[model samples]
Target: MGPVSSRKQSIVFIGGGPGGYESALVAAQLGADVTVVDRDGLGGAAVLTDCVPSKALIATSDFMSRFKAAGRLGVGFEGTGDDQHAEAHLSAVNRRILTLAKAQSRDIQAQVESVGGRVIQGTGRISGPREVEVTPDDGEARTLKADMVLVSVGCTPRVLPSAMPDGERILTWQQIYDLQELPEHLIVVGSGVTGAELAHAYLGLGCEVTLVSSRDRVLPGEDADAATVIENVFRRRGMKVLNRSRASGARRDGDGVVVSLEDGREVHGSHVLLAVGGIPQTSGLGLEEAGVEVNDGGYIQVDRVSRTAAPGIYAAGDCTGILPLASVAAMQGRTAVAHFLGDHVAPLNLRGVCANIFTDPEIATVGYSQADIESGKADGRIVTLPLSTNPRAKMRNINDGFVKLFARPGSNTVIGGVVVAPQASEMIYPIGVAVQNRLTAEQLASTFSVYPSMSGSIGEAARRLHSLES
Candidate 1:
């Protein structure tokens, strides 16, 4: 007599990006069998094309920004800031950095495989509510039946017909690596965080950079005051920021591109980097056939816990079209698995998610915003402390930016905050913890910060809120 085969429920995760791979690792640790499929290698677009590579380039720019501003900090420079002949100017080793960034991506792949989960290199789809079909690179077609399936397909750079990336004259953030030499004049289209960060990076790298913003200020999606500080700093750095300017298209003229703006204005440059946003990769994945709902933008609709309309299928990351950040993707993925496991779980809270734009005097915001509070969308009070007034600012030669906190009118609990200054990304973490843990202003104020540190401004802001409470 033959023994009967027993079947155990398996979790099939499609799309091997941050959302898929990270959760796959977590789910496996929780004693669930997981399989991840992707068109590219593991770690997905975030590691291969976006966050990791862009941050590597930004690191070079960060150092350069410091060198350019070093003179103001009482550091000696042999010549004028504009003097090309001067050896004391900011420089870059883009080639070395790009090489190192790629190596780091490979290392991420190694970590993903160590968790005893399977990552199949291929495209995948939801064949049915709880079924996944994978088209592997080896011409093998396999179907995976699972108790739950997670869709984390991620996204791709949005390209306009007018300025197709030629990988030389005009380029997307991903294609910028194809560049052999640093651009002499890089005209960046789009003034959002992506546009502003790259424009600032290129300018710091000694490129004559022009930032094109359709709005009156940079970082239109962020706090107005924060954007204003960055815009002012950009102008002061001679970045040639074109406000209220819209780029119509880009065309190759010989070896360069002349970016045509809406006002018949022409800006010629050695290269053009398109900092426009990305489109989620949801099409042709059999999503329509699987009874999953996709919005006008092609984003899959998911519930608070990342459950799609289809009972057994869930989606996360940029594929869900939530606010785009790698950290958010990871959280959504973990939430989806927790929800599927039938455990006590909470819906993902993006309010505590910190967003940073890596410009000189970086802008970081977390939780609720003053703009929302003032607009009546939220009810809260605000307290702002400019960095210039802080003793640390004077010692560090910091002349721009501030820390602004928002709290409920009566409860005085911090609802949200924004930091616009050097290393604002790092300073916003404590506020993020406070907001996430539902801590009150009094609780945050009680924490002591070292004197002569920028973080003291955060504690000071919390202390002022106590005065308002009294």
Candidate 2:
């Protein structure tokens, strides 16, 4: 669609996430007219506010969790040496969070620029069918022509107006870093992954924490047994978990915030973190006017290849209501470009994608789960091996989590696996590869694992399934 007059079949990407920038880079390399317009930095929410920063903070919090068990490992600490040493440790962690956030943002920007893509920092909206109107930095408005428009605007933290984030006492997930000092009595209102994660992070950092959940358990969306383990761990750490509770409002006290529940329960803390959920950043983007199909929940509706109902308009990442992860977003973007350029495009297979909640006793899952199979949602067999019996887990005094594997009944080919323990995110990679390649449990069991290692539990799980099949 290269034009004779003024156009070059422009490909305009309307966000800067893994999805947005990756596609922009690919299309640019393929000689398409590429421009990415975003309101904030090039990396969007994941790099700037959510994933990178949250993971950075989690790094220190993970250390705190390990420190609590150091005594069991014959490691002694003499009360941090002094008060000055304690303060130094806290400040070091805080500074590292900010440093990593900025560095990750810069790296994403550099990736886009290196690929010959134009990055315009502004709020972009669909002005017409093939044009995106952007308000430039200095308040100048410009319309960017597009032969194909890709919306990858990602998501925003959902906030209830009744309990809005003041960014001081009360804060959204994005506002967590603004605290000058550690939160004493950090009350997190929401018991999903985000809520559970922050509550655990603060609790590990020695903050008295309470978790509020409107459901019967934390991580209501996860496997029931996995959620139970996390809840027990939270309680063991002295976290006050208020299940079946809803937050009515929040108010700033003299030095803290008081959260009122619908059942007349009051939880007080130095800070309030609203871990409710996320909503797509779709409003005011001129989506409806351009006839792009949007789901009832306001997410852009697209096929597996990321093509929307509207002609020449595609969406990816969180905006498409697909699996919300930096990795998923990047793949979606690349696939959309492949389809647009008339190249062979494999439809997105979300089954093998791994999603990990970076919390103490981290939860990681790829593909199917035992619960999903038993409930008839999927067809598979489940074999679980407790870590208590694993040699490495016994050596580490770790008796909490287990490796649960799911595979087809007769063939015994691995379909999915879940790991619920420290560093489970990193350990779940082998299961991801096994599922992707349709490897049998017997083959996984045959692979050797280093003796006296946590990863040996993975091979043990596979061996258990092999025994069941025999």
The candidate scoring highest on lDDT is: 2
Going through the candidates in the order shown, the clash numbers are: 1, 0
Candidate 1's TM-score: 0.93
Worst 10 residues of 1 by lDDT: 84-93
Per-residue alpha-carbon lDDT of candidate 2 for residues 1-470, written as tens digits (9 for 90 to 100) = 32232434589998988889988988877767888887788778888888888877877777767766877989766755544222215566767787777787778778888878888888889999788898878778988888888999999999878788999889998988877688878889999878888888888878889898999999998877778888998899899999999999888889888999999978888889999889998999999999898988899999989998888899999888888788999999998987887656889999889989888788899998767787898898887777788888878778788888898889999999989887899999999999999999999999999998888989988998888889
Give the residue spans of candidate 1 off by over 4 A.
1-8, 77-92
On the 0 to 100 scale, the lDDT of residue 96 in model 1 is 63
lDDT of 1 by residue, 85-169 (tens): 3221222355665566667756656666676787788888777667788888988888888888999988888887888998878
- Residue 100 error, candidate 1, Å: 3.6
Report the error of model 1 at residue 250, Å. Answer: 1.2
Alpha-carbon TM-score of each model against the true structure: 0.93, 0.94
Worst 10 residues of 2 by lDDT: 81-90
RMSD of each predicted structure = 3.9, 2.9
